[model samples]
Target: MVRNRELLSSGNAAFAGLASSFSELSETLDRLASVADDRTAARAAGLKARLEEFSAKITFVGQVKAGKSALTNILAATPGLLPSDVNPWTSVVTTVAINTKAPADVEGPTNTKARFTFFSRDEWDNLVVGGGRLGELAERSGAQEELADIQRQVQAMRDATKARLGRHFELLLGQNHSYGYVDPELVERYVCLGDDVTPGEGNPQTGRFADITKSAELFLDIPEYDVSLTLCDTPGVNDTFMMREQITLRSLRGSELCVVVLSAHQALSTVDMALMRIISNLENRQIILFVNRVDELQDPAGQIDEIRSGILATLKKFNIASDVGIVFGSAKWGEAALMGSYDGLSADSRKALEQFGAMHPELAGRDEWETAWNLSGLPGLLNAVAERVSEGAGKRLLERVRRNARNLTNEARATLMARRSGGAAVTVDFAGHSASSVMQQLAAKYESDVAEVCQQLRDDLMQRMQSAESGFVKRATDSLLEHLERHGESGTWQYDPTGLRVLQRAAYLSFARAMSAKLSKLYEDAARHVEAIYSAVLSEAEGEFRIEAPHAPRVPAPVGLGKTIALDLQSTWWRRWWQKRRGYEAFAKDYAHLIRAEANSITRDLEENQVASVLENARAILREFLKEHQETIRRITQPDADTAEDARKALGVLQAGTDTGAAFGEILRGLDDMAA
Candidate 1:
């Protein structure tokens, strides 16, 4: 177990660093923005927005029916807040935020309410018409059966939506709208059982919640914990098709830690392995492998050992460098036990417990059962998570904020240098050419060099992206096509989500995994390009001037870019949600074209815009140097007192904000405040 004192100290230290750094950086940027031109101000605003958007992400991931929702309840310490019995196929991403301080606007004792966001009508129509991108591609390739299956699923979802939503169905499809302040008492009414479509008088019984809601969020004050925590309950990895899975993966990219829930009965299943592999690929993220339902095992200890060994072996085989903390427990028993109501267990669960007791007469007593139930490892798990958050996640978040501050500090220093050195500009005559002409020639040469490096980078990275995109899409398309070709109409929907739509869902998962790899590569490639460009530009500029651009920070891994392509591509409703803007028929007819077009568009967005943006920023550094020399000489020679005052004020603002010692002092003070 992580030491509580260590965790507290770490949290205080990290939070202090973050608060002070951000405060200083924000002040400096404000000062800079006041004096900067419109273009520079806009760019600074963009950077500021990015920094402000930094929030600690915690993602919950696991396989279908692994009691992930139950685990969520345990983590939140709010039993039954989320529907534990929700259909796994409906991949709705739910988020729960615990406030450290109660809201001033709210009247009561930190009341919990959920705000549900629904999908637009256009998105649903697109999914119906296009049959999703993979389905459409399969259809075009003469895979009639696969297309028909997709059409059937679409029709089923549409029919279910109408039956469940009734008149309200139309209300939800309009746009990205919110339905909020829903009482905690009726949380289940909004999230549970996708097919519960019966309409009631006052209570909205008829709601296509699974179909409509893209995501839901719950906010409440948890007075127990000292630190604020936001927990995300995501869809099971194999719950839906490709699209929602990708969304979950994209969400994971931002998360500091991932708690992977696994069922003891089926430990390290294929889908579990896939999900584990995904998290392992993510750099600088912590992981916890939680094996739920351990109470069901005949020999819990032996089974847990076997499960752990298997997981370790598989992770090694996959070459994942993750050190996962393994927790063995039963989410069901733990939740019920925590609520102080063992009778809350379903009749089926009660019967199962009885059978287990009968199987082992030696352990058949209320005391043993109580101990078993309490020994659900719930307390230990919570403590571990909190420690990790305080020790690792908090520090990482602070470090990222500091990196942004450092970058801004470099910018401020360069601007100061420009202002100070402008008066001492040197001019030289070279080979019958004027100093300005020679400078222009040098700029032109470096510009070409910059362009060449950028182009080569684009060529290499874009090719890799294109190759992966094409191959994965084709493979996914081909799998569905072949399945249809092989088993025309024999597939049936089973009670288990993994059983129903198995072929298509499996194909979707495979494709999603491929796309994730592709996306990770794209981010890695872009980061590399950014670093190379900055280094090259800095070298070239150093030859002429002392001013240089800041080193590129470790860019966060880019996810969700493939999400820009044609459809949700997931077996779930994300495809429906994503296609909100396009007409169904047009999307369907040109689905393949749309897929290719979207891929190209994303590639261009990254290869052209993103790469160019950073390089352009680098060039701005060089331009600033040149401009500084030119302006300073003119100002010094003219000796305008009024202009000098304005410059001095700007310089003063920066100097006050950029005091390293003062900032560190504030950081220390902040730590003291946290301790207090």
Candidate 2:
């Protein structure tokens, strides 16, 4: 624990230093903007906004009852802020926005500290009427009984919701509820399942809105850290209804880091194949596996290695990366430590902490509470998160900010020198040079090429989806036939979806890699063109000034591809369908048709939701990149006369021995250091 803290302390200090540097840099930009031209001032303002808005989004994902909420609360340093006993079926994606500005999507009064967004009417209608993906699965599998059951359940839920909220239930859809302040009770009102309370009969404040709530965003102030952090507690993957699974996937869209929580006793159990599939699909993300509830183990010191080994083997078996960081801890220990209550600890927990402490000489003499906290492994996990942020998003943001700062500062210096040198007589011919036209041509070509690639990939994926679906149906049919032959259709036959999952994963990976690579190349080409134009413009200036090339935009990997399909569900639909089967030939044909129908939905989802979305995002990025660079070219080529005059006046004031030049030089040095 001492070692973990040391590492965590170091990581925190390093991240704090980086944030301080950004703050200092932003301040310098503010000062510079006061005496700079319009273009420079605008650039400075933009940089400031980017710096202020930067946040490292991290999500916690795991199977149901995996202690995700408890771990999230511990990490956020707000124990019990989120309901640890949240129902597994709750679809809300709770975000703890710490040390950050409220998200733009959050709407309400300025003082609103918590926001609960309800599902849109369309979304709700789809879920209720369509029975979500599960209904589609049931319908395709000919499981009339299951389909009716799901519809009944959804109807009951809706009726209960309407009873609780009355007419306001209809009004609340597609709207949000906001609060001036947030507390556990208020949160439970919207997020808890309140299974203890009979429908429409309990305290209205308890889980009254959980059924309709789509997401919850809580603003929190934690001054211990400097950088903005958004910790997302996603719905569990192993949800019974699979509604939360889709919600979880959407929650993971923009998250750069994921913490997969696992129970020590059932780490990577067969029931958690959904969790494993999620891990396998997050190929480009930083993953941390936290084996929670280690205190439940009889020999914490002796069992940890074995558990870790088993987890690694499972990951390998699923073709997931084995290099993910694994930490063993108990959220109970974290809670106990945070409350400074040692007496609250169970005998088993206390004994586990003692054994953990004994294994590490540095922890031998530490306070029992502190030792327990260390044994909780929160510090180590926190340190890992901090390290990833520093090396990944933090580093990338700093580099881009520094580059832009350097270019803007250098441009300001060059403009001042040119004015002083009386370069007004120089007639640099920019006639017939249309950066806009050239960029448009380039952008059009890039878009066309990207479209071609997307179409090709989409077609290929469609083919693969069909092939995989056919293969799955054939295998399932054969398995059923064997079962029928052996037991004469009297017993149940479980059809594994592992083969389908593998095929889907491969298709997703192929699409992601291809799109990522193509987008990166296109962006690089666009950036290069912009750089060349900027260089040409600079070459025509009075003095020698070198501008740094614009950094390539960070293209987010494809999302929605990792989503859980209807086929992934484990149910008795197969047996139920088989019970009404005819002869082997007729049974096989009907089964194939039904399974194919279900598989076709997966194809449509991938194409419409995943593939189309990726293409649209890529195009938007390309267009935005080109648009910004075109503006940059215009700024360089066509300077505003009034702004130039204002800059001259500001420069004259600085030239009057105000030491502002020295300040500017210091800012440049800071940027250089940051870049280094």
Candidate 3:
């Protein structure tokens, strides 16, 4: 019997190509490390090392019940994942992805307490059954319950399942993360990880299956494979109304490709027909159809042809010009083959199995099929997809790099715009910046925004702080006035809020400017971290992996953000405000100590003060116009924050670290002192 394994049972063609790509990337990084000017090669080597953590992304997604779990069980080539007893039937999306390995293993970002987490199998179950329970993170306390309780419930559900699924793969659930008490390891995965959806309660659910959510995406690592393809396993759209909504909201409109599956017993339904039309409407994405449960058909062979023709007719009805493939097989049958369960298997099921058998790159005529060790044809279909996606390699990577680079560049510009004491001609050298120097420069140039971002980050910490403060202030201010009113009413007593001393503490917390300044420093600290990432990118950019922009500097571009300047735009009201604020020098004296402290804070780590000095000057300017980014955003955002101070702080936490979403949330809670 062939022992099922992650790569062995299922023949993965993408594995070889992806592995080759990884090898090239690794070798290229190593080569740069060996000879590139300025240890860029070393930095690239480091990034490459980190990238290696994402070495094997094995996506296992399909429509409804396409035996994805069974396939995973077979491929994991292990027991207990999709045991035969609880096997093949999955309503939830499960992902067993990998976190970082080797060293500095900070892999638990998908746990509870994580503002951003992917769904685990159990979490997926809760979503599949409960719906919005997965997205409960944004709901208010309603009639007066602690929001934390809801979060805890979500986390607990996830944590319990994760403990059960303890594997190398990082369990990432998109769209649906709420629903459980996840562990610390899973919690940390979201620390600074950024997601496509801009945080808040995104895409909610309305029914019983409210908890059912998008699938979990896993990036796996096999020994020789380098660039791992992210594997995703989806829930049955037909089963849940809310899940269908979530899928439409998150993936449909933007999908570059989609694989549709129809069970043999359940041919396309009205709902399926409608979904087919929607997916077909997408001009950019291609949809591949799978005729699942083929083994269940009475005349499996004749039915396969009829099913193909039937699907073609159905596709025509939906105006989907592309012909869909009709694979007559079963995830259960495939599992049976992989597990060595043959004699009891039906003869027709075995024949249907052999048909799918012919599609597998590793199992064709291998005699393994006779003993039932062959994997599904799904791998072949997915590999075909990989080939299509990889055809134009550098183009996609370039776009991705450029986009990320531009975002970093834009923030850098925003931070530095304030420090222009005066300089002309782009003929100056920008090499030789030390790590400490870069940190200081980052802190110095964007200190105010950084501080604001930091303060905003204190949200969770600050919310309860502010919520408590809000309560105290309201009571104190109102009660104090009422006491004086009562004195008038009594005519015999002179009274004040000596009884409500708690208000005094509240009063102390009400100093907006002080809160602003404190948050400013916090933001600066956070920005320092963001700058570190940018600095890392730039430090690496000047050498081997250096991005060549559309202009002079070569940089990675995504979505084609160009130097006509988008993310890294050089001008914003914040910078202008900073210039005006500093030009006065009037408040400089009062702020002298704070400014110096901030400058010291910025300069502390730097070996040289000059680079820090230049950066500091920039920050001095941006601090004054702290409202710029926020002001514009508010016009576009719903339930907008009243002031830029809060927004800037929030932005700082997000931009400051690798886990942008989580950091934004964590930092937002931290600066609760500023909230209303």
Candidate 4:
């Protein structure tokens, strides 16, 4: 075993450096808290808590048989941990938490390392009765035969599951299983789709429980990486049942980075266009396209450039941004390099490795295994991920921590100066009742304003969505007519839904931009109102104390809006629907109505689910901000006896020629240096 030759050393070093800085920042805050006032100490503690709780979440997504699990295993440095040959019917979403604690909701012993959650009763009923999203789509398209087919499949799955688990199936719903240890057999029992043994039988390692499993979470302590990482392996997008597609989309919404694995032989097929649409919906996520199984190519060294070019061209043709990093490699090569099993490689793979080495002469002088590792492209991929982490979440966290620290230190200095002065204690005459009343009025006004804004935005978005739907119906109807004239509708006519997807994307983007701008302005206005109130009340005080306004909270963009509609599905039901509708004029007219109804459902989902949620969260955040600042005002205007005594003690310590002021100044300077 090559223990020291870890492929993730570079990325691990980057994360370790950032973790060290975070630790230092936390320690500095602790030191400041010991000698600071109550409010400053609380602020420092909050900053430290945020530092400790930060983690980067990355999700791996791709179609079925795209080598996602294989690539995930190689990246996490735990080869063979996940089964690479998952069946298409498997719907489990596996998450690997590296150097991070299990989620708070997970209940288990301290030694528990794996948790498998089953679907709730409601969720199972939805899949069975509602037929998931595919049934909805089929009904909207008036494809009765297709809808029945979907329901039949669902019923068959339910019956098979009941037979396998007997009466324990219902008992397992809404429950989770935890294990103190994990192995391949343990993982396969919950994640794989094989059905050799029954669940209620004496065989405990059967995959019969896999169908009802919702998620699998594995916690591992990998010492190579110093920071926390959550790697989620979502089910493939091309499942026949389409349940995994919904699961995958939900996973994407929670992730900050996405690694899209593609089979090198069929890099980007038409079926993968849904994946493209999903990627396009990610607002500020970092995406890397990894073309796996390149070792299967006859001449990887000679074919890599052409493959890269073709993939880039496809992206450009689709109007996607060109900055998405693309890397070509084979996970098998990485596994071999990790285990130092060069002798086990086939002759052709060995020859290809040699050729890869010759292509990059810089590695000729290094060990052959090292060269093979580089040829795997895992090193490059890791470096790219590290770079993104450093520039994205890591940078933002460091900035926020430094800003809060400086502000707290400045406030502490102001408090000290006020205490040291021999002047009478400054006090504002604003009563607590009056402050509460004023805040209530402001909160009511904010609520009213937000409601009005959301209503208007909703109306505008609905109009746009309707228009897009009408245009798509017209175009699709015309296409259907053309197909009828050409082939008399005897055979199936399959039309691309890319146009509808594009229009829907435009509407979604418009909604995102408008909501973001309006809500951000509202947040700023609310902050200013509170600040103005503070300024007015504090002006009545007699001292020259300086109090900075609270920092404005960042408004999050509307989420859960990237839902993949049924129209984007490339299932056979679409063609079957067309074939069932043989007449031309009636087919076009009925199809148009069905499409219009689907559009209505889509619009309603956006308004009620996505838009409504955003507005509610925004209001809650605004309310919290106002409430905190109100408390702050009350604390400053009416300091308790304990706080006054603490201030006096701090002032006396300062009077004894303590270097507290100089220390604060040094901390400020350090913050400035970090900002630079």
Query: By how many angstroms RMSD does model 3 differ from the true structure?
Result: 24.0
For model 4, what is the error of residue 349's alpha carbon versus the real structure, in angstroms, after optimal superposition? 2.0
Q: In candidate 3, what are the lDDT values of residues 525-635, reduced to their tens digit?
A: 543454334444332222111111221111111111000111111223223323333222322232232222322221222213222332333344344323323221122
Pairs that collide, model 4? none
- State the lDDT at 619 in candidate 3: 42
Residue-level lDDT for 497 in candidate 2 = 66
Candidate 2 lands at a TM-score of 0.85
lDDT of 1 by residue, 1-676 (tens): 1111121222233354454555555555565455553333555576565445444557788766678778776556666677766665465788877653222334333443556666666666767766654454445344456677877887887787788778878877644333335443455555554444345544454233667676777775554444566778887766433445655765675577788788888877665645654665444337777788876776665566788788778767654454666777787766565565666667665555555446445545556435445456665566556657656655555444344333333333333343443323333345675444544554555445545554554455555667755655555445444554665424411111111122222333344344334433433443343333223322123221222222322223333242223332334333332243244333333434444554555555444534455445544534443343334333423335544554565456557775532343343344334334
TM per model?
Answer: 0.58, 0.85, 0.42, 0.87
CA lDDT, every prediction? 0.52, 0.73, 0.38, 0.73
Q: Give lDDT for model 1.
A: 0.52
Error of 3 at 268 (Å): 2.9
Cα-based lDDT at residue 441, candidate 3: 55
lDDT of 4 by residue, 1-676 (tens): 4343455565776566677778878888988887787777887899898888777778888988798888777666777788888877789999988777766554677677899999999999988886888777777776677778888999998998898799999999999999888877889889986645555764565577898999999988776776777889998887766787788777775566888889888887777876876776564347888898888888888888888888888887776677887889988888788777875478887778777778898887887667788898888777767767777777778776776676577556545554554322445445545654576678789878877877787788778888998898888889878988988867665556667656766887787678778877887787668656555544334232322332333322223334455555556766766666656877787777766676667667666656666667666666655666665554444456765786677777777888776677677667667767
**Ten contiguous residues minimizing lDDT sum, candidate 2:** 1-10
lDDT: the better of candidates 1 and 4? 4
> If both were scored by TM-score, which would come out higher, candidate 2 or candidate 4?
4
For candidate 2, list the clashing residue pairs, or say none: none
- Lowest summed-lDDT stretch of 10 residues in model 3? 556-565
Model 3 scores a TM of 0.42
